[model samples]
Every structure is written in C-alpha cells, then in structure tokens.
Target: MLQTLDIEHRLKSTLDEFVADWGLDAEITAETWLVEDLGFDSIDVIQFIVAVETAFDKRNVGFQELIMQDGRYVDDLSVGQMATFLEARLPAA
Candidate 1:
C-alpha cells in the first residue's frame, strides 16, 4: 500500500502538471485550495478530476463523495484533502 505521504507527493505532482497545462501562474502545495487559490470553476474542477484519474491510472474514485455533501457541491477543497481521499481509494502498489 502507498503511504499517505507518497500519495500526497504524487497528487501534488499531478496538480503541478495540471497547473502547467492550464497556464496557471501559481505554486501548488498541500494547502493550496482548488477554488480560492487556483480560481478553478466547476468545469475546471471536472477537467482536473479527469487529469488526476489519468495521472493515477485509476477511475471512479468516488470524487462525488469528496466534492458533494448534503446533495450540494462543496465550496472548495485543499490539495491535502484530495490526497487523503485518493489514498484511501487507490489500490495497493
């Protein structure tokens, strides 16, 4: 199984690529907020989700549960939060 730190590092790398691909001028870290820091909209979030899935070589990681609560989309998410969620769902490696 991948350790928590491993997942965080990998996720951060993926985010770095996403930021570059979008031509975003920002530094990514565990505390970086997707919406507040990156200025990501809903469509951007969906695209990022796909990018993350491709980077990790996995799909259906239940991002809905992470992005939604009480039938409403959450306002924002930090990189660390996403790493934790992905760590739990990704299979052993």
Candidate 2:
C-alpha cells in the first residue's frame, strides 16, 4: 500500500510539473493557494484539476468540493490540502 507520505510526495511532484508546464510564476508548497498565490483563474483552476487527475491516474475525482465556496475558490485552499484529498481518493497499492 502506498503510504500517506508517498502520496503527498507524488502530489507535490505532479503539482511541480503542472506549474512548470503552465509557466506559473509562483512557488508551490503545502500552503500555496491555487488561485491567489499561483495566479490561477477559474479556467486555469479547472485545467489544473484535470491535470492533477491525470497525473495521479485517477478519474472522476472532484476537487471542487474542496476548493470551491460561494461559486469561487476558497482563499485558503492549499496544495497540501489537495494532496490530502487525493491520498484519500487513490486506492492503496
């Protein structure tokens, strides 16, 4: 089974590649905000969520529940939070 730490590491790596490929001008960390800190608008956020789903090789994973509120992303949504969310969704192996 993949440990929690392993999942987090993979999540971080995936996010790193996402940021690089998109040419985002912000540092990605556990506490980095996707919309505010990373400069991701609504469309970018959707694209990023798709990229993360692909990166983790998981489908139908919903991140909007975690990041969205009142039709907008919550300001405090962080990379670490997303990692934690993914860790729960990904099957252990």
Candidate 3:
C-alpha cells in the first residue's frame, strides 16, 4: 500500500484530475463540502464516483456503502478518512 502521507497527495491528484475532467476550478480540500462548498449535484457526484471507482478499479464502493441517509459524511469525507478507507480496501502493494 502507499505510505499514509502519500495518500493525501494521491487524493489531491485524484481531485485535480476530476476537476480538470469536469472543467471546474472549485478547490477541493479535506474540509470542502462536495455539495454546499463545491456545488456538486447528483450528476457531479456520480461523475466523481465514477472517477474514484476508476482510480482504484474498485467499482463504486464509495457510493455502494452510502445509502440515502448517509447525509453529510458523503460530502465531508476528509483526506485522512479517505486514506484510511483506501488503505484497508485497496490491494496491498
């Protein structure tokens, strides 16, 4: 697996790629709200979901784990939290 610190870099790169793909300049930080802060609607979320799935070749696990009631956690996932999730779930290096 990637080093824990490296995960943040990876997340930033992934977010950068996603933004570039979508022609968006909205900054995505660990604290950025995907909806309120970034203005990501359902289609944007779905596109980001697809990008994340493709990043790890892990299908759509993020969305899969989120039911309708997941609420803010879905948009408020921090870099650290995403790192933890990816470390546990992604294939070992």
Candidate 4:
C-alpha cells in the first residue's frame, strides 16, 4: 500500500502540472487552497478535477463527496485535503 506521504507527493506533482498548464506561477503546498490561494474559478476547478482524475486514472471515485457538503459546493479545498481524499479511494500500490 502507498503511504500517506507518497500520496501527498504524487498529488502535489499532479497539481504542479495543472498549474503549469494554466500558466500560474504560484507554488503548490499542502496548505494551498484551490480557490483562495490559487484563485480558481468554477471552470478552473472543473478543469482541475479532470486533471486530478486523469492523473490518478480514477473517474468514479466520488469526488462529489469531497467537494460538496450539506448539498452545497464547498468554498475551497486545500492540497492536503485532496491528497487525503485520494489516498482513501486509490487502490493499493
């Protein structure tokens, strides 16, 4: 099974690729927020979701559960939060 730190590192690398494609210069860290720190809008967030799913080769991992709360979309998400969520869903490596 992959360790938590391994998951985080891979996730961060995926995020770095996404940021580069978007031409953003900000550094991605565990504490970096998608909306607040990266200034991602709704479309950007959707694109980011696609990037993450493609990176992990997961399309039905229930990302809605992580992005939604109380039947509403979340305001923001941190890189660490995303890594934790993916870690739970990804198969053993």
lDDT of 2 by residue, 3-86 (tens): 667866776787788778666667667778777787777777777788878877887877777877789767656777887887
Candidate 4 RMSD to the correct structure: 1.4
| Order by TM-score, highest first | 1, 4, 2, 3
Looking at model 4, report the run of 10 residues with the lowest lDDT sum: 16-25
Candidate 1 lDDT at 22 equals: 71
Off by over 4 Å in 3: 21-26, 60-62, 66-80
Q: Write the per-residue lDDT of candidate 3 for residues 42-69, one digit (tens) a residue.
A: 7776776677767767774645455234
Which parts of model 2 are misplaced by more than 4 Å? 21-25, 69-76
Please estimate how well model 4 matches the true structure, expressed as its whole-model Cα lDDT: 0.85
Model 2 clash count equals: 0
Instruction: Choose the strongest candidate by lDDT.
Output: 1
Compute the lDDT for candidate 1.
0.90
Residue 5's lDDT within candidate 4 is 90
For all candidates, the clash counts are: 0, 0, 1, 0
Q: Could you tell me which 10 consecutive residues in candidate 1 have the lowest summed lDDT?
A: 17-26
Compute the lDDT of residue 44 as modeled in candidate 4. Answer: 82
lDDT of each: 0.90, 0.75, 0.63, 0.85
